[model samples]
Target: MKIAVIDAQGAGLGKTVIKKIRKEIGLNIHITALGTNPTATSNMLKAGANHGLTGENSICNFCNTNSLDSIIGPIGIICSGGIKGEITSSISQSVFNLNCTKYIIPMQKHGIYIPGTINLKIKNIIEEIVSDIKKNIEKLS
Candidate 1:
């Protein structure tokens, strides 16, 4: 299965998510790191993503043409001018329009909050994400 992990700015969250996915999901799945900047892309690549793409155009083009099974990222990815303005409207629109399952991490930094996720930690959230991805892969298999 092919999955894209999107992130912006420092990409600290992306890197951690990639690492967990790699460690828990193994290497069978293809991971694409879609970053808003080169640094973010580089960091996620180092975390073991099979492929990496940087910038708004690259990310949008990739999402447009690729048949991704899932897209995982902070909820801000869908908001224009999010991630400290690194996420553009075009990028957000492309991701939002993708015909794939989306796993959005509710981040407080984005100033958007989900009612039930208030007490959830980032690590726990990512663990849940990995588990869900595993289930999806199993279903496809």
Candidate 2:
């Protein structure tokens, strides 16, 4: 499956999510890292993303047309304004607008709100997503 992970600043749980997905599932999956900046994208790439893209065109390029099976990130992945302005309504709308399936993680316990996060109940949500994907894949095979 192709999974797109959007991290606006790489400060949130994107890295952790990627690590868990790789270690726990141990499956050959395509992970795309979409970062607001190169650093965020690189961090996820290091974590395990097979491909990484960042910056303005990067957002416009993949946010809409990319055929990702799923997108995982914090609620802010859709935030429409701020530094670099990469994360905009179009980007958020594209993701929120994706006809494809998606898995969105909520904020941390403190409700402090990170720029981009895709796991709220991180462990449980990821487990559920992985479980469902595995089941669907097995059925398809």
Candidate 3:
């Protein structure tokens, strides 16, 4: 499956998510790291993603042309004005409208609170994401 992981800024979250996905899911899956900046994309690629793209254009273009099995990212990504405005309206809207399943990391930040996700640790949330991806990997091929 082609799984896109979107992140911006430091991309520490994307790196961690990619690392876990690589180690846990192995080579059978192809991961695409889509970052708002080059640094974020570089970091995620270093974490073992099969491919990486940088910028809002890349994100929007991919969303427009690709048929993905799943898109995984922080909830912040779907917010139109997130990541200090690096994530544009087009990017947010495209991702928000993707026909594929979306696996979002629920969290409270930037005055936004994901309902029912209070007190959930980031590590625990990541583990759950990996588990969910693993369960769905069999359908990839």
Candidate 4:
């Protein structure tokens, strides 16, 4: 299955998620790192994403044309001007309108809170995301 992991800023979260997905989900899944900047994309690529793209236009264009099975990233990805303005309205709109399942990580740092998820650890959240991806892959197969 093809999955895109989007991130901005330093991309530490994206890198960690990619590493966990690679280790837990194995190499069968195709991972695309969609970063707001080159550094973020490069870091996620180093973490084992099969491919990567950087910047707003590249991300928007790719998402528009590609058939992604899923998209995983911080909640900010769907919010215009999220990630300290790294996420543009076009990027948010493209990702939000994509015909694919999206796994959004709720980070309090983003200033948005989901009550039930407030105390959940990022590791646990990623595990859940990976597990769900595995299930989706199984269903497709």
Q: CA lDDT of 59 in candidate 4?
A: 99
Computed on alpha carbons, the lDDT of every model, listed in order, comes to 0.94, 0.73, 0.87, 0.94
Q: What tens digits encode model 4's per-residue C-alpha lDDT throughout 1-141?
A: 999999999899999999998898899999999999999999999999999999999999999999999999999998999999999999999999999999999999667888898789999999999999989989988
Q: Provide the global lDDT of candidate 3 against the true structure.
A: 0.87
Taking every candidate in turn, the Cα RMSD to the unseen true structure, in Å, is 0.8, 4.3, 1.3, 0.8
**Which wins on TM-score, candidate 2 or candidate 3?**
3
Query: Over the stretch 8-111, how does candidate 3's per-residue lDDT look in tens digits?
Result: 99889899998988888888888899999999999999999899988988899999999998888888788888877777899999899899989888757656
Q: If scored against the real structure, what TM-score would every candidate get? A: 0.97, 0.79, 0.93, 0.97
Q: Model 3: number of clashes?
A: 0
Q: Which pairs of residues clash in candidate 3, taking residues 3 or more apart in a chain or in different chains? A: none
State the lDDT at 107 in candidate 3: 58
Q: Please give, for residues 1-141, the per-residue lDDT of candidate 1 as tens digits.
A: 999999998799999999999899899999999999999999999999998999989999999999999999999999999998899999999999999999999988777878988889999999999999999989988
Between candidates 2 and 3, name the one with more favorable lDDT: 3
Error of 1 at 48 (Å): 0.1
